[model samples]
Target: MTTTSGFLLDQVMVTRGETRLLDTITAHLPGGHCTAVVGPSGAGKSTLLRLLNRLDDPSSGRILLDGIPITELDVLDLRRRVGLVAQQPVLLTDRVAEDLRVGRSELGDHGIRELLQRVGLPVEFVQRRTSELSGGEAQRVCLARALAVEPEVLLLDEPTSALDGVSSGVIVEAARDHVAAGGTVVLVSHDLAVVRGIADTVLVLDHGHLIAHGHPDEIDYLEAGR
Candidate 1:
């Protein structure tokens, strides 16, 4: 699988009437690395992730993937290349297996089982109904489904927030593995510990503005809360 060079946000901004959701945010997410976006609530971390995948377009400026403007790319192709595992897992089908196979028909039963295992889920869960899953279980299934597509860049929005310690570790390990295999990962999280554990670099946002960009160890955690 080919890896993407990375993403570039050049003066990206988003506004809703009088509200500014993002304010001329500019940053570079290096390829083959895990970059964490962190801050207090309503910091626009999720908005940044959504913009990366064209789930929401910026009001101004450009977002580039490997030096090319994402606006010029096909929306469907862009999403497939940059897969997103949302904060809330939205299962498309009733059955877990069906949900995983929705757009990834190339993934067979064996592939599905492997993906489940990667996310610390039991193979038997494949036949289970999506409604029967716990919040954490459903989240893991969503992560697995995203991996099944083998996207070049993975955008995770607090992916482990609903999970237990073991499950969270499993998810983090999967992310680490993805980066090691040449995929780029952009994570949004409030958990400082999770960011420190997996992020090579950190971007701090506050009230829709870029506040800081540095190594995880170099950031002042206290200031990020404000």
Candidate 2:
């Protein structure tokens, strides 16, 4: 994983017709740290996460990655460096090892097994059929796949939203380990427990507006009914 001064969003806004999904969201998410984005449903959380990896370009504004505007970089190269694990895990291949090697072809069985362990999967899972694993296991494999390239940043969109506590814990541990090892993580989560547990900084959004940016305790999830 590569670490550098991270994302800078300048007056970013996203709109579709008359509706704004994000209203001038500006903030600097430091490298090698975990930043959690929290908001109620319909508050533009997913839309915000998509822009980080150019899954969707911002309607208007500048997003800089490692001091260069992301728009100026090749889309594929940028995505390679900024890997994303969406809420749902969609295994690209039928086999686990093949799915993990999608980004780096030279990744061997040993490397694939190591990645699986890192995400809390048994090494034996290296040869398991994707369709045979449970939801939690598939999600972990998806996370390992993202980590396989050793990306500069991990853009996780509600990764643990649908998992059980045990599964969620594994994912949270993986994110923390990534940051501890100097990789950046940007997470969008509605589960307040997740935000408080792993977030070094929290960004609160409401109705397309950035309402708060500070430590996790700064945002009162109770009062906001998050």
Runs of candidate 2 with Cα error greater than 4 angstroms are 1-4, 222-225
> Which candidate achieves the best lDDT against the true structure?
1
Clashes of each: 0, 0
Model 2 root-mean-square deviation: 2.3
Please list the C-alpha lDDT of all candidates, in the order they appear.
Answer: 0.91, 0.88
Best by TM-score: 1
What would the TM-scores of all predictions be?
Answer: 0.95, 0.94
TM-score of 2: 0.94
List candidate 1 segments past 4 Å from native: 1-4, 222-226
lDDT of 2 by residue, 1-226 (tens): 2333789889999999999999999988888899988888889988988898899999889999888899999999988889999888899999999999999999999999889888888999988999998887888889999999989899998988778998789889999999988889999988888888999988888999998888877777624555
lDDT of 1: 0.91
